[model samples]
Target chain A: MNPPLLDVRGLTLRYETDAGLVTATSRVSFQVNRSDRYVLLGPSGCGKSTLLKAVGGYLAPAEGQILLKGAPIRKPGPDRMMVFQEFDQLLPWCTVTQNVTFALTASGRLKAAEAEERARHYIAKVGLARFADRFPHTLSGGMKQRVAIARGMAMEPDILLMDEPYAALDALTRRSMQDELLQLWEEIRFTVLFVTHSIPEAIKLGTRILLLTPHPGRVKAEHRSDGTDPAGPDGELLSERIHRELFSDAREEEAGHV
Target chain B: MSDSGTVRLPLPAARTGAAPAQRRRVWRNSPLLRKACILLVLACVWQIYAVQLDKPLLFPTLTDTLQALWSSLASGALFTRIGFTLRTLLMGYAAGILLAGVVTALAVGSRLGNDLLETFTAMFNPLPAIALLPLSLLWFGLGNGSLIFVLVHSVLWPTALSTHAGFRAVSPTLRMVGRNYGLTGLRLVLRILVPAAFPSILTGLKNGWAFAWRTLIAAELVFGVSSGAGGLGWFIYENKNQLEIPSVFAGLLTVILIGLFVENLIFRTIERRTVRRWGMQA
Candidate 1:
């Protein structure tokens, strides 16, 4: 069998805070195959975002290593484009189209005209074609994030690293955005390493979900989905089983639960 | 029982989301009108004081000062001197701003650059520009050179200090975003730090302009003719010596007017276009 698209082994991450060395993750391991909708789901402060950031090449592993294809991950490159949670991630000075084109032109991957053409294509895909010339500040929060995701997708990276891209939106917008993302994924078949705390989102989006334990995050379990239905009768049953494993806190309960 | 006697009241049209109220104010809404009233009051105070003194040599009357101002306007010599003073100030201000840019660029580029900026500003920011006049005269001789030298010193430190502070204030996420796209060195500084910290940088430019203006006037007053001619400062000095007290007052008034015009017109317009539009400042 071909090696997984991304191989992470015995990875550890820590922060040197003013008070002490805070361990965020300890010897966690996982693998992602090509075109896989891999979801890293856990509660807040569970080091899930930190783990994704490590894969994005922003943070280094303290112990084991993350391998992409066959090479070790060292620095951030255009190969792993990121979509951050903040609305201000879009450059305020650049128009929506310019924001995406800049990433292409600045990385020396495409000429100005070509970059602009691709930028418009993605902007259209995200339903922001009319606002192509508007500055980021003029756009709403959801619109700004759309521009950010467009810029990331325009790079056509090996894998898109999304850190809770829809977490900040209102419920109605978030639901619609999630649907849009899934539809876009179906069309492109691009690999995405998605991180979120919502259980239903994992069941709906992930081809496979990796559940992590609280605090210093550790891999608890992994589950596969049918990949054909979200509202199918079987989906409800799987979501409930996954929910139980997460909130049960088996090890914590043994210590009389903090 | 209550349903038999109860009455319902209609809400105000605005409360019920009818036509919005007219966007207008009842107070003195026009800034121009308010400024005119203030000038009129100040003129009255000046007239009263001059009447009490009853002397042109010691304290010229409002009318006598106006007469001096009119004669100068007619001669055109006052305009020439004002122009010269302004030209000198502009040269120094531009140089000072350029140097500050370099200093700030260095500060953000590396640790060593930051240290140099901090060390130099600490050493010289408090040293008055007028104090350097003697040294500048000895070095540059009696021309625009000496005047400009002192003016540059006055403008440089504050500008560099403020710009460095602004660079430090740019958001970390923005910095990471720039870096992730492979931006480093000058491109990163220009595309990211400059716009992010423009509010503080503008504050620096304003401070530098004020400092340069004062330094230019003081240097010219103490040193006499520069580049073979006297500017407004020399005009004030010569008029005072000749006992043309009203003309001296007129020269001082010219200085005040120019300062006011620049602060209100040029700088305020720039502020409106940039930081205010960006919503960085109100």
Candidate 2:
């Protein structure tokens, strides 16, 4: 059998603060196959985003290793493009087209003219072809996120690591953005390792969801959902089951505290 | 509970989402017109005060100063002075900027460079450039060299300080995004740090320009006596010795006009094109 596209073996992550070393995650392990809509779902402070960042090579692993196609992941590279949560992710100086083109050209993956052409293609895919020449500041929060998504897509990286990319949007915009992401996934079949705290979001987006416990996140469980259906063949809600699984840890911790 | 009858009325027809008629912008609201009016009032006050004082030696009337300015322009002496002063100022300013660039690059490159920048700026930034004139003259020997030295001194510290601060203030998210694209070292600095820090850098450049201009004028006032040929400062100084008070006022007016032109026209245009365009500045 072919090795998983991404392998996390006994991964541990920590960062320094004013106080001291803070462990974000410990002994977490997961594998993402090609085209897997892998979602890391957990409560806040669970280090889900940190896990995604570690995969992106922004955060160093304190133990074990992260391997991409059997090769160790090191510093950030063009191979794993990241879509961040903040709207400021897009360079304020560049227009939508230029922002996307910059990702391609700056990575040296494509020349200027070719990058521009591919940039426009992805911009069109994101329904931002009309605003291709407009700057990021002029676009709404949703539109700016769209430009960021286009920039990541334009790179055509080995995998796209997204860290709560739609969490900052309003309810309506968030729903629409989720739909748009699924649509994009349909058209391109791109591999995405998505991080979110919302249970429904996890069920809605991920083909396989990796549940993590709160604080110093550790793998709780991994569940496979029938790709676009939130309902199982047995007529149970996936969100309810996942919610129980996540909160069971919280209840046990509360009992211990009491 | 009893049922109550309610009346419904049709709303009156009104203009709904129609475009407003296009009209010319009001002259009363024009910034240029407002500023010009303020200047005119100030000029009138100066004219009235000078005429009442009737002491041309101390304070020349507005009309007399204008006459001196006109005569100087006609003889081309004033033009020569202005040209000499600008040439010297440009030389010093360019050298200052070059040195500031090097210092800033060094500061951004490493921790030691940052410490050096901080320590050097703290030592020099507060020292008035005019205070360095005597030492500059002794070193460079009574020429444009001395004037240029003081001007560079005035420009360098402020430019380097602001630029270093700007680079330090670039958002970490932006830095990460740049690095994520495989941009490293010089490429990362150019693509991310420089542009992101531009608003601060521009502020630095403006501060440096003002400092250099002030230092050049003050330096020339003293250095002009030692050097045979000099610029507007010399013109003003020579007139003061000969009791040409009106000519001295004319030289002063030329200085103000040049300052205004650079601030309003040159710097404003650069600000509009870059920082304002990028929405980094209001």
Q: Given candidate 1, what's the lDDT at residue B135?
A: 94
Report the TM-score of candidate 2, chain B only. Answer: 0.87
What is the C-alpha lDDT profile of model 2 across B1-282, one tens digit per residue? 333322222122123312221112444457777788799999999999999999999999999999999999999999989998999999999999999999999988888998998999999988998899899878988788888888888889999999989998888878989989989998999998898899999999999999988888887788674445688888898999999999999999999999989988999999998888777872
Per-candidate Cα lDDT values, in order, are 0.86, 0.89
Clashes of 2: 0
| Regions more than 4 Å wrong, model 1 | A1-3, A226-236, A250-258, B1-28, B40-54, B59-76, B110-128, B131-146
lDDT of 1 by residue, A67-185 (tens): 99989999877888888888878776678998999999887779999999999999999999999998788888899888988898899988998989888999889888888888999
**Ten residues in sequence with the least summed lDDT for candidate 2 chain B:** B5-14
Interface DockQ per candidate: 0.39, 0.59
Output the number of the DockQ-best candidate: 2
Residue B234 error, candidate 2, Å: 1.9
Error of 2 at A14 (Å): 1.9
Q: Name the DockQ score for candidate 1.
A: 0.39
